[model samples]
Target: MRLDQMSGAKLEQDGSSWQAYAEQPLTFQFSFGDLQTNQDKIAVFVRSVENGQPEAWVQASDGEYQLTLAQPGHYTFEFKARDQAFNYSPVTAVDVTAIPVPAMISVPLLGEVEVRIFQLLVLFGSLAIFGFGYVSFEIVQHRRRIVAAVERGYNPYISGEPVRRVDMFFGRHDLLRRIVSTLHNNSIMIHGERRIGKTTLLYQLANALQEVEDEEFWFVSVYIDLEGTTEEEFFHLLMDEIAQTVRELPELAPEQIEILNGLLNLHLAENQYTDREFNRDLRQIIHILEEYGAVQHRGCQVRLILLMDEMDTLSRFNHLIQQQLRRIFMRDFAATLGAVVAGIEISKEWERVESPWFNLFNEIAMAPFSTDEAIQLLTEPVRGYYMFEPDALDFIVEHSDGRPYRLQQYALEAVNQMLHHKRRVITLADVLVAHELIQLSGQQPKGSWGEDAARGELGVPQTPAPAT
Candidate 1:
């Protein structure tokens, strides 16, 4: 089959591009000629000039196709003709480019027209939803298809689920990198309320450490959920988990694993198996780990990171436990043994008992997602399957305010709303509807200003985080 006409043909493979309006839909028409009349169908591929990811593509017999590429970036297109005999012929191979030309395309700010307009609207104090289209059935069906496609393609946004899998987790790249770097040399206190993604951040720390490169010390992470855990339980769990973590670490000799296990079991076999014995041997184990890294395989040294999550449980532990932790982190083997403590108020817990060991950690204040990171958290989970209109995405970011749980939950609801309206793309109006529904369901955040803030609220103050 041969092509009839290509839209935006000024787009050239030589890096030249056609300046198409952002959000403009490009259409191409194809027809079967006498020579290719026996063709079963023709396949079309569209790719972004920036990342080479497709904007849209489909196999069709002979017809017109359209896709609204709202992202303002360089894009390329290709067309292929496949015959009934399965023979393929090229119509265009990376031939055309579409570049979006918007008034504020050069703005350092993110999102698109919606964000720009919303900023302006905020200044004018008129953020009310002036007009919105009625939800259409086609939009709902389209949105459902996208939601289902997302579930099949990548990890779907599950409410209350910590992003254990790396792919499901989005954004926080810079934060994760920073935490990992800090963990290499020092321990950190992750300060944030529960459900703000502290657990996932800790998991991501483990995930990043799992791919440790040679020469860098391999941090054997022992994740300890300290919520409701007593001091005795902590001792038992820490020893049990060290055995488990050894197995998960990289480049451990059979002797190395046995040595670690034997060390832990030997301490447990103490006549009393008391906290005193647990503390002493745990330090010995930390020293052994440090030595292993310095001597064994020319890979990561035996550094270990204790992911002490829900650190609030320390409130229930006695000063002995605190003293033990202090000596362990500060005196025993600070160089090789790192810890990441996650909790609502790390300082508050430390204040319950004055401990200089708390001073050893560089505090990492876990704040809400930033705008750009929020965009990735919103889009990456559903990449390639569906898209959020600039305004819709901005609206969600504004309402959710970088709290990952709210963002995912609201985005999921918006998808449901889109599916209910048979829409493939989420719009500002859709976000508003979802916002209202969430508010009605009693899930809206407390302390939010009423309708004025709800409609066109601008710059609601976020909770101030303590300085690190």
Candidate 2:
């Protein structure tokens, strides 16, 4: 007898007594031969030992048999072949050892509960690995993009300082036009809260005065910052600024500048310079300017406009000192000398009916930017370098309450957020991030957003935006 075509079993040795190792279920084919009888007359009988079942000789007419070893044990099968005359051949036996599958296999000997726990652990572990890999990839890509945006240098907002560049200034068109049209004959007073662009407007007015093309009047604008001036040094500082400004005029010759300097030095000396002396020296300076304008500008009159900033300090002086200033503007020099004073508020002393400054000049109140102005301010500064989504622009405008300073602060932080995320188009989510950062640092705006507080600290540089 020969065993062949075995599956799920590996034969250890080849002989009449065969030993094999297998994992159930195992199957094999057998064949028997007799010299005196035909192949069909042959019969094979099999019995098992120590297989956890009843042992008996079972006649197997077929040439194939199968064994299912449900338990781990040593199993033996004895086989005998019988010829047609009932003659029996020598017995052949095969031994097999059934063993447990590897623990790494899909199914193990663990109970049903343990099997479910193992399956759940595998599923959760796979999810965690996938999640970790996905997050790592996103972080790497974000870092690469930030590096690229930084290399491009795309910041275009200003904060924490006054705007100095003319192109960077926005809005105030009607106010500027009105101020210029009446600046020749009328003195103007500009009053507004702090950080409302008062200083910037004064600088703009000076620049605008230089560009005005007047046929009859030569406009010479002199800027005087009265931030720390006292009543004692008032006349001295005024003469000094006048002399410095007049010396820079291109039309004045060297000898003419020397004469103007000499006149200014007379009142700027250590002596107690009174308003009368100031008036005298200013009269002489105006005569010099008028003569120069006559000869060089075809007889145009000389109009000297003083753009004084930080005038709030003047309120600390006594009413008499304020009267002296009003007297100087109310004299004959009123025709040739004009004043544009800017401050946070007009002194209460000036509101009195009989006060010297009660009706001295035309007052223009400063206001926050309008919606259209805010849009222009946000977009024009970064027209080509970056862009703002419509909702982002609306978010800034609505939260900032159309205040130029707050608008700049919001824009500064929002652009920083965009740079951090390496984005060119600013979105509402970026604005929300900026708001959260500002709130965390206790720099959020007041009035519209919350209680009254001092202005926020926004430390962005004041560089001019790139030209469109």
Whole-structure CA lDDT of model 1? 0.64
Instruction: Identify the runs in model 2 with alpha carbons over 4 angstroms from their true place.
Output: 1-152, 264-271, 347-349, 443-462, 465-468
What 10-residue stretch in candidate 2 is worst by lDDT? 447-456
TM-score of each: 0.57, 0.62
Q: Which candidate is the best by lDDT?
A: 2
Query: On a 0 to 100 scale, what is the lDDT of residue 238 in model 2?
Result: 84
Report the lDDT tens digits of candidate 1 across residue range 1-468: 445665642222344434555566666676543375543443433334445665455665356656565666655666665555656665554334445553543344554455567668566564243222224555665566555543332224446667677666677778989887777788888888768888888887888887767466766788888777766666776676766766565676677666666664445543345556566667656665665667654556667788988887875678787777677667666666778888887666665437544466777778888899788878865565568899898788888878888887677667666656655677888788778887888863321212122322212211111101
Native-to-model Cα distance after best TM-score fit, residue 80 in candidate 1, in Å: 65
In the range 1-468, model 2's lDDT, one tens digit per residue, is 776566665444445344454454667678889878998888888888875664988987578888776666777777888988889988877777666543342545554344556778889999999999999997886655444434444455655566667888887778888999998789999988777888888888888988888877879999999998888888778888987888787778777777786774564553577677787788878877877887777767888999988888887777787888887888767788899998887745466797668988798889988999888988887664568999999998998777777787777778777766767788888888777766777763321212112212222222544211
In candidate 1, position 220 carries an lDDT of 78
